[model samples]
Target: MINRRDALRASGLATFGALALGAVDAGLTPAEATASGQLRGWTPLPDPAAGGVTSPPFPKNLTAEERRNLKTFDELDFTVFSSADWARLDESHAKHVRVHWPDGHYTDGIQKHIDDLAALFVWAPDTNIQVHPLRVAKGNLTAVTGVMRGTFSAPMPDGKGGYIEPTGRQYAINMATVGLWNRRGTMDEEFLFWDNQTFYSQIGL
Candidate 1:
């Protein structure tokens, strides 16, 4: 299998080459990046666990409360959001669906989502997955907010967290690009779908 960094570099889109999540040195001139729009893309931020700044740009449009809400460490909850089929899970979608983190206390739907993806991994080992550095995208400010896609992979548990007991198993990477939003967060997963290897789309799932 191609290594994660190479695969991400190979992931073509608005994020190609250095624009795809990079390390922007502290105190570097913004002009160095402004000259290239690539500079505006998500830079490898300081790890939040170390208690540094969170989402520094704040997208310029979020309310103070919204911005403040962005500063917590909730990766497990956020990853579910990243991989969630939002139209089916997010009430915010055009067609609202119940949150796995449902309003009516603990629900089976929530547990099932975990069970389902875990089963999928066990059922299909050929599938390659990666979860990685999460980022957010700022749009028109008055409208939608965005989540950077993440990478998840094997030799690690894939969607296999949240089990209730000792048999709790992990089969995919614990690392994920699970970005939380002040509002609706997202997943910028660099995933590919294949149809017999001849016709397939390298999808950002």
Candidate 2:
């Protein structure tokens, strides 16, 4: 049986070579990406995790507060394409929110995560994240999946506390996120996952 990596390559979900990366770096920004744009066309083969199933089932007897919290989370997620106002995020996140990223980047508080994200927006001014159609909410946990599209327009942190100059490359990758809300209905913790190889390949790294 083909391995997961092989399967992703075979399905065209993952593209290879420096040329693929170089081509996108030649001025492809988020404004040029459409709902059916080429930059966002690479989709992985259907996986069980991404199946069209809503967790916690229908007729979700969620409380008004729960519903409101979920709604706020959705709004916050959309800020990647707009202004990621720190004060705004502060209002929606707990004072000590914990954030986890698949790449091992971790933030122990809301302010730190906001700072990190603010830097990302500066490097990729046109970054955009589009939420998936399915969202699952159960108890204090809420989950969402989405696509991230962005252009590296300025120098970016290399995850080693170092930095790399802009490559002008545009990238699109699938992302998943889960969050736990505090008693105040603000998100207190979150976990995010994405394909790092896909991202690196798109940026010609």
Candidate 3:
């Protein structure tokens, strides 16, 4: 006379009891026992780099140009945002590259973009970003989505000849960028988009 919900609840309680018993017998806490692989029928998550069975594979039939564009995009994200290697901008961006921000402001050239990023890093030295989970490249265009995480532990510019004191708060915001590549395998135009309100709320601004 057991309903499906009751049966599921009973099964869950039984499983928890077994786990608790196993933990006590092994002289460990329940959490420690679970983490130590005591849970029956539990499978560890597969390595993302190994492209597990559940992961959708990238297109294997990409053209040479498309592959090059994708590689360049990855390098750009690593060097420019993750690694903060401003000097290497030439490797992935044209000298005349233009970068557009969500606020409708745009950097005219690579040097200008470097200056803008430098000021940002001054505000948040621990800034680190990674592009992943969603990357697409076709012909001379590439798009990537990821999160930018950092701690606001330094004074920030107020754009009015003054500075705002550090808040020491951390923020992570989802962002996306689309790039128009040139024939030289470097980005000529990049458009970045993110929710400004979410970012400001997270940092208590």
Candidate 4:
């Protein structure tokens, strides 16, 4: 069984990957994007020193698919921070969630999922992900795009026990995820894609 921590972590990676693709379309190399200190029309990456919420509040009116998509982001942005939030996953995800990441890695069950999330935070302590308004929702599928911005301050682990040294540079990249919901109205599987090379190249990893 996937633990609550794994489920939250897995969701964060998938969500970040899916939303990062938007950076590629913007014609900004991850380095170029962070160098400018903005993401063009998208919201500016939050200043870690100046603390404030960057993600918009969930809209009052939403389509079924949109609500589901928003739930995923909420889990990453809000619920994952607290142990109590694990219950939120039960309401929004299956016990046996499956995840696919951009690096062609796969994980099932919750414990593996939590491990991914832990690895990510370890590399970028102040990383932040937010949803953009542009979303597509149809039936059991929903796609939300956004940006992930953070400074690579510590050695990042490769999951194989190796680690990538931080370049001490910040990165802003586009991400997008297509979520598949089970019959229970929860996300069962997610397909995530982002420019790993772009991210690595930006951070000089």
**TM-score, per-candidate, Cα-based:** 0.25, 0.65, 0.69, 0.61
lDDT of 4 by residue, 1-205 (tens): 8443344346765444433344344332232445657654454556322334345444434566667766765565444523334435556557688887888787896556666665666878777664353354444655655566788999987768898778899887776666677667777876666789988888886
lDDT of 4 at 33: 46
RMSD to true structure for each model, in Å:
13.5, 13.7, 16.0, 10.7
Q: What lDDT would each prediction earn against the true structure?
A: 0.30, 0.62, 0.66, 0.61
Model 2 Cα displacement at 175 (Å)? 0.8
Which runs of model 4 end up more than 4 angstroms from their true locations?
A: 1-69, 78-91, 158-163
What shift in Å separates residue 72 of candidate 1 from its native position after superposition? Answer: 6.3
Error of 3 at 4 (Å): 54
Give the better candidate number (1 or 4) by lDDT. Answer: 4
Tens digit per residue, CA lDDT, model 1, 1-205: 7344344334423232233233223221232456545655445555432333333343334445333433322333344344443233332211121222212222234344445445434433333322223323222111111222222222333346633222222222212221223244322122211121211111212
**TM-score: which is higher, 3 or 4?**
3
Flag the better candidate by TM-score, 1 or 2. Answer: 2
For 1-205, candidate 3 gives per-residue lDDT tens digits of 7342333234433432443344335433222335666765334544322333231223345568867877776676655666788998888889999887877777888999888877878878888765354455555655555567788899998999999998999887776676778888888877777779988887779
**Top-down TM-score ranking:** 3, 2, 4, 1
Q: How far is candidate 4 from the true structure (C-alpha RMSD, Å)?
A: 10.7
Better of 1 and 2 by lDDT: 2
Q: Where in model 2 is the C-alpha error above 4 Å?
A: 1-61, 157-163
